[model samples]
Target: MSNSKLYKGSINTIILKLLNEHNKMYGYEITQKVKDLTKGELNITEGALYPALHKLEAEGLLDVEIAKVDNRLRKYYKLTENGTKETANKLEELADYIKTMQTLINPKLA
Candidate 1:
């Protein structure tokens, strides 16, 4: 399976979890953080990342702030009030999904 296809469902949860931990982050910073955390195993493309961010913003789950830095405007994202509440729930859901996958892969472990 393609990496994007495999990861298509969990990107929102991943982004929420990162924002939960870091308070705020910009797009490229978020991408690099994911790569570094995963030891380069997962690569989040701009094509995927930006759309997800936009969707989350539209859903009222994320708030954006713009800052002028080094002659460029940077947009940073942080979880909104609803997003903060949803982040915990999403993390739980993602964990459950992981456990289910593990159980399917190893019945003996289950």
Candidate 2:
């Protein structure tokens, strides 16, 4: 599958989990971090990422802080308390999804 196609459904959960682990991250930093963490298996484009970030922020699951970093304004995103709880739920859901898919894809193995 194409990188975007493969990860479309899981991006939000990945982003949330990353923020849960790191506390806070900016947009580019988040993308780069995901690339690093996944060993390039997932490549998140700006077109896809910023919208999700904005949506999450709008939904009150995220808090943004604007700060100067090396003379450039950067918006950092951190999960709110509600976001943390939501992330936990989302992670569990993702785990279950993976298990289900695995079973469906290789029922003989199971």
Candidate 3:
């Protein structure tokens, strides 16, 4: 499996969390935000970003708005009602996972 595979499973959660914090964001914006936040440790590629966005939209957890910018259309994503709820749940789940990882990776911290 690819190194990015580990982060693949949490893509939705990451997207939801970002949308939860920011009202809406475009695809490239999201990628930049992640890179900036992680200090370039995590870079979200187009291949991984779009599919996850479409999946979340299809699942009714995300809402999209298209706007004309610089003579081009830009799609911005935000959390829907269900997505807001899901974001909270996903955040909690991520927190739990972090705790588990901490225990496993640094037992002294646990």
TM-score, candidate number 2: 0.93
Off by over 4 Å in 1: 1-4
Q: For candidate 1, what is the lDDT? A: 0.93
Predicted structure with the largest TM-score when compared to the true one: 1
Summed over model 2, clashes come to: 0
What residue runs in model 3 are displaced by over 4 Å at the alpha carbon? 1-3
**Candidates arranged by lDDT, highest first:** 1, 3, 2
Candidate 1 lDDT at 19 equals 97
Q: What Cα-based lDDT does every candidate model obtain? A: 0.93, 0.89, 0.92
Q: Show how many residue pairs clash in every candidate, following the order shown.
A: 0, 0, 0
lDDT of 3 by residue, 15-107 (tens): 999999999999999999998998888888888899999999999999999999999999999999999999999989999999999999999
Once all C-alphas are superposed, what RMSD does model 1 give against the true structure? 1.6
- lDDT tens digits, residues 1-110, model 2? 13767588887888899999999999999889988888988789898899999999999999999999899898999999999999999999998988898899999865
Question: Candidate 2 — which residues are off by over 4 angstroms?
Answer: none
